[model samples]
Target: MDGSSTTTALVKAARAGDGDAMDRLYRRFAPVVHGILLSRVQAADADDLTQDVFETALQRLHELREDAAFPGWISRIARRAALDAWRRRAPFTGEIPEAASPADSVESHRDAEQALAAIRSLPEAYRETLVLRLVEGLTGPEIAERTGLTPGSVRVNLHRGMAQLRERLGLREHER
Candidate 1:
C-alpha cells in the first residue's frame, strides 16, 4: 500500500486503541510536529511541546473526522500548542540562551542558532515551511501531503522562503 493509505490505516487502528498503530503514527509524524513546534517556539521547548502535541492528538483521536486527515489534523494541533506556549512565555529579550551539545562545536552551534533566529523572524507561513523542509528534512511533496497544502503552494513557499532566507543570511544565490 502507499504511504497515505498506510497512514490512514494506522490512524484508524490508533483510534481503535491499537498501541502499535499509535506508535507507528507517532514515528511517522513526530518530525513534522517537532518541526512545526520548532518554527514557533524556542528550540528547547519544541521537543517537550512535540510530546504535548502527540498526547493531545491521542486524546482527541475520536474527534478527528477522517482517518486520512491525521497529518493535517495533528499539524494543526502542533501549531495551536506552539502558539499557546508562545503566549505563555515571557517576551523575547533578543538573547537566546546557548544550548550546545557536547558533540557540537561552539561555532557550529552559534551558526545554527543564528540561522534559526533568522527563520523565526520570517512570516509564519515561510517559517513553518522552511523549518519542515530545511531542519526536519522533509521534501516539498511530503510537506504538501502532511500540511494539506497544494503542491504548487508548497513549491512557491519554499522558493520564496529560501530567497528571503538567503537575503536574511546575507548569502548570494551562488553561495547556496
Candidate 2:
C-alpha cells in the first residue's frame, strides 16, 4: 500500500533469496548509493565503487540487525568503502594538487587534495557524516535512514562536522 511497507516486503523477499526481490531492492536503493559515491568520489571511479557497495550490501544483508534498518546498514558500508577509496587515491597527503582540477584558471584551480586533506583531518565519525551530506549530497533523513542512526544523530554529526570544517578552514565561528 505504502512505500515503507513495500520496501519492507521487498527486503523480506530479498532475504529469502528471491531474484526478483533482489532486483527490486537494487532498483529502490541503487540511486541513493550511486548519488553518494558520485558526490564523494571522482566521477570516473564513482560508478565502479557504487557497484561495489551494492554487491557488498547484498552479500551482507543477512547480517543486518533489522529489516527496517537496511538503509542505514548499507549506508555505513558505503561510507566505509568510500573512505577506503579516498585513502587509496594518492601515495602521500598534502594539498590536493591543482592537477586534480578540471581547469587551469587561477580561480578555477581549486585544489582537491587540500580540500580532502581538510576533510580527512576531521574526527572519523564527523568526517563520514559531513561527506555524506556535503559531498554525497544526501539529506539528513536520508543519511539517517541509510546509516541506521537516528535523525538526531545525523544532525549532530552535521553540526559538529560543519564546526570542525570551519575551524580547519581557519575561519572563526560566527556567534549569531
Candidate 3:
C-alpha cells in the first residue's frame, strides 16, 4: 500500500484500540509536530509540546472524522500546544535584546542559530511554512500536500519568508 493507504489503515487500527498502530502513528508524525512546535517555541519546550500534541491526538483519535486529515489536525494541535506554553510563560509581551555576536566575523556570517531565531520571529504563516520546508526538509509540494494549504499559498509564504529572512540577515535582494 501507498503512504496514504498505510496511514488510513493505521488510523483505523488505532481507532480500534490497536496499540501498535497507535505507536506507528506516533512514530510517523512526531517529527512533523516537533518541527511545528520548534518553529514557535524553545527546543526543550518543543520536545515537550511534541509529546503533548501526540498524546492529545491519541486521546482524541476516535473523534477524528477523516483519517487522511491527521497531518493537518495534529499540526493544529501542535500549534495550540505552543500557544498554551506561551500563555503559561507570561501574561505580557516584551522584547528581549539580542546577545552580543562572536568575535570571529567569518564564523558569525553563517550563524544558523541566529537565522533560526529570526525565522521564529516571523509571522505565523511564513514561520510555519519556512520551518516545514527548511528545517523539516519538506518540499513546497509536500508541505502543501501535508498541511492542506494551497500550492500558491505555500509558494507565496516561502517567497515572502525568504525575503524577510534575507532582509533580517542583511543580504541584498539580488543575493537571494
Candidate 4:
C-alpha cells in the first residue's frame, strides 16, 4: 500500500484503541510535530510541547472527520500548543543558554544553535518549512505530506528560506 493509505490504516487502528497502532503513529509523526513546535517555540520547550500536541490529538481523535487529514490536523494542534507555550514563556534575556550534551563538540553545538537561530528568524511560512526540512531531516515530499503543503510550495519555501539563512549566516552560495 502507499504511505498515505498505511497512515490512514494506522489512524483507524489508533482510533479503535489499538495501543500498538498509536505507538507506530507517534513514532512516524513525532518529528513533524516537534518541527512544528520548534517553529513557534524555544527548542527546549519544543520536545515537551510535541508530547502535549500528540496527547491532545489522541484525546480528540474522534473529532477528526477524515483519517487522511491526520497530518494536517495534528499539525494544527502542534501550532496551537506552541502558541500556548509561547504565551506562557518566561521573558528571554539576552543570554543564549547552552544546550549541548557532553558528547557534542562545543564548536559544532554552537554552530548548530546559530543556524537554528537564523532559521527561526525567517518568516513563519519559511521558518516552519525549513525547520521540518533541515532540522527534522525530512525530505521535501515528506514535509509536504506532513504539513499539507503542495510540493511546489514546499520547494519554493525551501529555496527562499535557504537563501535567507545563507545571508543571515554570511555564507556564499558555494559554501553550502
Candidate 5:
C-alpha cells in the first residue's frame, strides 16, 4: 500500500487497540512533534512532552472523528503540550543553557539569542508555523495535515514569518 493508505490502516488499528499500530503511529509522528517543541522548549522538556503527546493521542484515539486526520490531531496535542511546558517554565533572562566557555561561546550564544528573540517577536500563528517549517522541517502539506491548517494558510504563515524574520535579521531578502 501507499504511505497514505498505510497511515490510514495504522490509525484505524491503533484506535482499535492494536499495540503495534500505536507504535507505528508513534514512530511516524514523533519527529514532527519533537521538532515543533524544540524551538520553544528545552530539549529535555521536548522529549518528555513528546511522550506525553503520544500517550495522550493513544488514550484518546477512540475519540478521533476522522482517522485520516490523525496527524493533525496529534499535531494539535503536541502544540498544546509544548505551550503548557512553556507556561510551567520559570521566568529567566540569563542564558538558557549553562555556559562553560565565556570567550568561545559569544557567537553561538548570540545566534541562540537572536533565534529566540525572533521567534518571540513573531505573531502566534507565524511563530508556530515558522517553527514547524524551519525547525521541524515539515512540508506545507505535512504541517497542514498535522496542524489542521489549510495548505494556503500554511503558505501565508510561512511567507509572513519569513518577512518578519528578514526584518528581525536586517536581511534584504526573505528566507524560510
Candidate 6:
C-alpha cells in the first residue's frame, strides 16, 4: 500500500484502540507536529507541545470522522496546541504580547536561529512554507501532502519566500 493508504489503515486501527497502531502513527507524524509547533513557539515549548498534540490526537481519535483526513486533522490539532500554549503564557487582558526577543537582535548565532528569525519576518504564507521545508526538513511534496496545499502553491511560496530572504540578507540578485 502507498503512504496515504498505510496512514489510513493506521488511523483506523488507532481509532479502534490499537496501541501499536497509535505508536506507529505517532512515529510517522511526530516531526510534522513538532514542526508546526516549532513554527509558532520556542523550541523547548515545541517539544513539549509535540507530545501534547499526539496525546490529544490519540485521545480524540474516535472523534475523527475520516482517516484520510488524518494529516490535516492532526495539523489542526498541533496548531491549536501551539495557540493554547501561547494563550497560557499571556495575560488574559485581550492584548497581544510582542514576539521579539533580545536574541534576535544579537545576531551572534548566525548559523541556525538567525536564519529562522529572517524566515519568521517574512509574511505568514512565506514563513510557514519556509519553516516546514527548511526547519522541519520536509520536501515540497511532503509539505503539500501534509498541509493540504496544492503542490504549485508550496513551490511558489518557497520560491517567493527564498527571494525575500535573499533581499533581506543583502544577497545580490545574481547570487540566487
Instruction: Give the alpha carbon lDDT tens digit for every residue of 1-176 in model 2.
Output: 64556667888888899889888877777666765554456655667887899789789889986788777677677768877998889533343344555466655444444455677677766766777777667788766765566889889988998888878777675741
lDDT of 3: 0.80
Alpha carbon lDDT of each predicted model? 0.87, 0.71, 0.80, 0.85, 0.77, 0.80
Cα RMSDs, all models? 1.7, 4.4, 4.3, 1.9, 3.5, 5.2
* Deviating ranges (above 4 Å) for candidate 6: 90-108, 174-176
Q: Quantify how close model 4 is to the true structure by its C-alpha RMSD in Å.
A: 1.9
Candidate 6 C-alpha lDDT tens digits along 53-135: 99899888888998989998998999899889988885222211234343443444443555666776788778778888887
Q: State the lDDT of candidate 4 residue by residue for 1-176, as single tens digits.
A: 86688789999999999999999989989999999888777777888888888899899999999999998899899988887887888733322356436677778777877887788789988999999988899999988877778889999999999889999999987887
Better of 2 and 5 by TM-score: 5
Using Cα atoms with residue i matched to residue i, what is each candidate's TM-score against the true structure? 0.91, 0.67, 0.79, 0.90, 0.79, 0.82
Candidate 2 vs candidate 3: the TM-score winner is: 3
When 1 and 5 are scored with lDDT, the better candidate is 1
TM-score, structure 6 vs. true: 0.82
Better of 1 and 4 by TM-score: 1
- Give Cα distance to truth, residue 21, candidate 2, Å: 5.3
For model 3, state the Cα shift of residue 34 in Å: 1.0
Q: How much does candidate 3 score in TM-score?
A: 0.79
Q: Pick the candidate with the highest lDDT.
A: 1
Tens-place lDDT per residue, model 3, 105-143, is 645545766787788878989989898888788888767
Candidate 1 lDDT tens digits, 1-176: 97789899999999889999999989888989999998888777888999999999999999999998888899999999988988999744434466436577788777887888889888888988999999999999888877778889999998889889999999986887
